[model samples]
Target chain A: MKTLIKNAVCLIILLTAVIVNGSGQEYVKLERSRNLQLNNTSAGQEISINVTDEYNYLRIKVEGQFTMGSLLIELIDPSGNISRNFTIEAGGVNTSDIRADRAGAVSGQMQKAFRNPAEGYWQVRITPRKATGSLRIYSLQIYNPRTDLIELEQIEKDTDEHIG
Target chain B: MNISVRAPISKKSIAALVPFLLVSVSTSLAQHKITVDIETDTTIWAPVAYLSLIPDFNYLNTISYNHIIEQSGISKEGLYEFSTEYLPEEEHLYRVHFSKKGDPPASLILGGRDHNHFFLFAERNSNISVTVKSGNRFINDLIFQGYSPNKALQGINTMLEALDSIDQNGNIVNREYAIEAIYEDIKTYADTCSFPLPSLYALYNINYAKDYDNNPAFYRRYLHKWRSQKSLYFREFRSSIRGEIKPSWLIVIIAGSVMLSIILTMYLYSRLKKKNNKNPLSELTIQERKVFNLLKQGKSNKEIAEECSVSVSTIKSHVNSIYSKLDVRSRRDILDIEY
Candidate 1:
């Protein structure tokens, strides 16, 4: 019995070392999923993320039940310039200028690569006309080529805090 | 006499030893470690850094992480560690690159001129420490400790950075000439450096062909000096130069071909001279020569008698004398003789 326990401990330690040594590359700094009920009179929902020059890419995803031509998503840079505006169309989503849009059958994902991202807060404004459903928004700050699916500690939740 | 012989290891004993063997192997693999502490004020670098092994001493290949051996995330305390025993016993080049999110899998940003990567030298048993601080560039910010070759490489990197700053700032009037001067400095370092690996790295940065053309003797001497080194970098440097013809051997081959051609021509000329010395007519009198010329022109013995103003019997005696002097038996034999 003692020998069996010793063998199990050794096996566990070896596996743990291997796992810890290979972990961590891409970091997820911000992920927020919000379900909203919007009408023609409701105010537009705005989501903002702090993008330092170190961040190489930013991705925005929108999903859930919504009518065609009812939801509009706008990406604003640090200078308050609207870099991209996404609109929900029949069977897909269309962007104003940026071309990296992979709209799934249910959800639409928009990814943007920055050569040198401006060091300030970026905004995502979502306006809906008589829409009711849940919308998920998450941003990943890529650090290198390696990918690891590990969530970091220290998760903060707020209703609408201005970020920088 | 009674003798107790030990039996082979039983299946139970073998099974019991398996976990211990695995633990020993894992511990051995974990013996070497490279740790980096990021001290940068600005958030330019990503949280992840890659450790890549360079297959050769070619400095240009260091730009890409094609041979990534390990990838580790920086801890919350800004410490990144790569622990592995897979490294070869001999020291080799390794790059630790900190790239931003969305960066390419290989190479640095801005056509590999980005300063996010630094190099180090380590063997399988080496433990290295690095500190990255805030500076003008990544190389300027790096402080590598423990490995002597890494320190030597860092010194070369500092010089190269200084040289490049001049070009980047447009401080020199003749950019082309200034760049050539910088290459000359690197060549001088390569020639004088005591470390073979760092020396090879420095040598590969400059135009090898131009240097070899300008002074092939330097390469010959350098090759001879480092020929016996056991480092794979030295071996690679030697093989890279082998692609070109060794200048001294080329001279020997060209000179040998010219001498061989000269000797062959002289031998043929002497043979022709000996043949020329054997004149057929030198053995005959003037009357016999006239008779020989008439016989060569298809004139019979009677015709030769008319042409030479001699009797037919005298012409026949001259023909026989001509045949004997020239070593021929017939008139056709005389025609076949080469002058």
Candidate 2:
């Protein structure tokens, strides 16, 4: 009877640890992952990835300097579902889809369910319909339910291979 | 022998023949005096007559006769002094009689000769003539004709003509009665004539201006006064014309248009206000309100599912239902509702 109880306690602790570890995974961060430098003449550009889990979440922070026109950010999920598609404009401190006639910085976030979107491949597409001057994106991040250990290890190995 | 018989009857025969011849001669030449003479300074003339016998003393004793004879005056001792006054001159009639005691009581008509008797006569054979001086016969004739502007103007014209004739010729040759007649005509015309404004203005301006020539002082003063008076007259005439109020068709049309516009504006405003007051949101159900409130609060499908203890798929169905009820699509439309 004593052995059974001790075993039961050990099993409960292990299960609790697994649940806590799964639930508390670190959010995925993409820090200037795409070395994109948009100038006055650059066209539309896109960055995308396939998210396997339906319960995963995504958070994107876009920072850029654009002169004239607006920057459109669109999220296209795997199941052909669109979510949190919006346009960020220049020249104002607040997040506005429409800006006045001047050059300035813009930053905003968009979140959505990963299960279904209006398009395949979890995507972030930036379109500058009338961008003038230089447009440089400083940061962009995507949040998911998966743990960061595997992704960080994979990024380190790719960097070492590129160096060799 | 014949001569001796004739001498014997001579005294008686002579006596009878002398008386017979004297009686016949005296009867043939017998005469009586019945003369009448009008004694007045006024030039009014009329016929005079005295009746010696009454045809019926009781029925016609107080006889009243309207003598409208043509001539009037007196005659005496075979000399006739007829009134020189003309037919249309002063002609008046009078009733006369023997008013004295112990005299023959007979009615007489005296004065202006008309259509009746012309002379006074007594029952006894008498020699008589009537003599009358001229009176104001011209004025009397005009008055008897009645007051008329045309007749009065004619009289004035006649007097002016006479004056012109007298001025041209240095003669008292025209009868005194004619001079007197003209004077009387002028007086009567002056009394009856009423001058109109146009004629009076012309006369006043002409006569008033004639007094001064070299120095325009009088004219200046008179012009100022006359201008004021003329302006006053025109103002009075204008007021008289304007004071006459008559209804105009334009007045009725304007009044009716104002009234109709007011009524139409009030009716349309009332209808619009009534329609706006009856909102469709008042018919919304509790479930619909909950969904709508959450939508307005900007909750995602997962947040709404957790709050309502339902699956995310169930929340999607509720969102669709809310959209149909609110008649809107997309999350951006939630803020556009009036309520």
TM-score of each candidate structure, all chains considered together: 0.47, 0.20
Best by DockQ: 1
Candidate 1's DockQ is: 0.01
Tens-place lDDT per residue, model 1, B71-106, is 777687778888746688877888776654443333
* Fnat scores for every prediction: 0.00, 0.00
Give the DockQ-based CAPRI class for model 2.
incorrect
TM-score of chain A of 1: 0.50
- Name the TM-score of candidate 2: 0.20
Residue-wise lDDT of candidate 2 within A15-131, one digit each (tens)?
Answer: 999976765555454444344555556789777664433423222333344434555666554444333354544433322221223214432233322111122355667786665
True contacts kept of 2: 0.00
In candidate 2, how many clashes are counted? 33
**Model 1 agreement with the true structure over A1-164: per-residue lDDT tens digits:** 99999999999999998866555323434444455555446668788878764543344333333323345666687768655454432223223211233221122333333323455887888886654434555554443333221222111112112211
